[model samples]
Target: MNAEPVRPPAEAPTTELERADDGAAEPDATEQETAAPEPAQQELAAREQAAREQAAEPSERETAEPVPPEPSKTAEASPAESVPTQNLPRDPARASDVLVHRALPLIRSGELGLAEATLDRAWELDPRNPQAMAGYAALYVAAKDGDRALKWAKKAVRRRSRRPQYHVLYGDALQLQGDVTGARKAWTRALSLDPGNREAKARLADTSAQAAK
Candidate 1:
């Protein structure tokens, strides 16, 4: 015959202590959980995430990256660059001479208004310029204003007493004003200043011949 394993004999539990032990042992709910409590676990995870972000992120106001300084929009200019080189201040006398030279051609062309305007600007630059005075004299002579011409010619002679050209201009103005004696005296003075003055010689010869007649 085959032998069978012996087992313990069954007995019924009837006492309170025996009954409690005999009932199926209930598993502790707290021991059954694999993780911590829900609230504590969530709080721990939030703290870990915040710590990771803080370590990885840079400060908002500061950085290790190099940034170049921007150029200023209102930087000061150098003295030479700040001021214009063109149209610098010119000498009044030289500017006056340029204007007077421009006027003489217009006078010869009988553009009296334009000549007078230009000479006026020259005079404004240099009031005592003898060339400017002589230019005015020529302009009035061309315009047939004998008295004005005489006035400006006299001013020219007063300004430059030794220039024979100015003396010739004076004599011409005197002749225009019908002052024959004054004109002859001016021509004689011009001849004394310049022995080679053909205009003075011719004028004297013409007047002497007229007087003899």
Candidate 2:
């Protein structure tokens, strides 16, 4: 009643051959992996070396040296550090004083433009110069610029009140502005300060004559 399982001798031999073939194919794949191309590896190494060389090379700017600074004239002239002096009146005033004095003759001769040019130079040299300030004030007054004349005259008076010419100039400006009382008071103050000031005396006489009219 029971049937027995049968084994084929030919089939067993065929299964053994197939297992050997699989083993042989695994060894061939291993050989192929070991024999992979070396050219790509060499190229990668060469590129890395080239990058390192480029990083090591000096740039155009780094190789060039810096230019030295030029020597200053003042530094060469003196070894010791010098102190700056305040602008004070020169013991005997320079050509600036002469220029201011010459401007007066131009002003007297009715050459306002020439007088103004000289005074401008004199004031530039000595900014707080009384004579130059007064001369410039007078020039401005002659040019009919009362505001500038008053400004310069005030500066002149502030610089040197002993020079009564500045007060006369201020008085003249006040007179032009129709402030007769203020002009009279300024002229009176100028005369009181410098009793022998010829210009102040002349202006006071003119003011009195004009007021009487």
Candidate 3:
């Protein structure tokens, strides 16, 4: 026997070596499987960092003081409250004068409804008040209601015949009604009561010039 040439026990079968290599490769695969979660972990960390950043920022309400609301533009003062101390009348007799003074601008500005309401209130405050009656007469003249203007004008003169302004108002109402003679007499009476009455003087001049024409 040739001493049994044992070639290293036939060098273990090639298939057995291949099997060992395969076994070694299994551990590398397991390591690769474990490392696969690193990308997912990085994504999760990125999301957590973004959440922290957002939480660190301040909100508008938390960063600044709250602003107060502005006052309303349409807020109005009460009639009594709106009147200044100087505008308030000293007595009941002058109450209608105060009201008329306040209403004139409103009437001129085409706020006739408001002026009427104010004059009505003045009348309620002082019934048969000369100034209130005169105010109504003036308002009716502005509205082109000649009958009502004449009626209120007569009432104003009846209430206070001595007041030159009342006679002037009556004259204006009479002039609106085409009563030229009546207007002239009323205006003449106003000038007699108040010699320096510029309005009465101007009206008399106008009436006399018209009569001459």
RMSD of each: 17.4, 12.0, 7.5
TM-score, cand. 1 vs. native: 0.55
Best by lDDT: 1
Candidate 1 segments exceeding 4 Å error: 1-89
Q: If both were scored by lDDT, which would come out higher, candidate 2 or candidate 3?
A: 3
**Candidate 3: which stretches are off by over 4 Å?**
1-97
What lDDT does candidate 3 reach at residue 194? Answer: 100
User: What is the total number of backbone clashes in candidate 2?
Assistant: 0
Q: Please report, as a residue range, the 10-residue window in candidate 3 with the lowest summed lDDT.
A: 78-87
| Candidate 1 lDDT over residue span 1-213, tens digit each | 989988888876589987878796877787678435678888999999999999899886567677789989757663323322234239988888887888888888887777787788788889999999999988887877899999999999999999887888888889899988999999999999999999899999999999999
Clash pairs detected, candidate 3? none
Candidate 3 on 1-213: residue-level lDDT in tens? Answer: 559665654465568778888777445777887766788798998999999998999978898998999998767765544443345676766776687778778778877777887887777778867778888998998898889999999998998899998899889899899998999899999999999999999999988898789
Per-candidate TM-score against the hidden true structure:
0.55, 0.52, 0.55
Candidate 2 structure quality by residue, lDDT tens digits, 1-213:
787878665544457778888778455776776677578887998999999998899977889898798887666433112211224347434656776887787778887766777777676777767888888888887877878888888888888876677898988877766777888788888999989988788888987898789
Q: Which residue pairs show collisions in model 1?
A: none
Compared with the true structure, all predictions reach lDDT values of 0.84, 0.76, 0.83
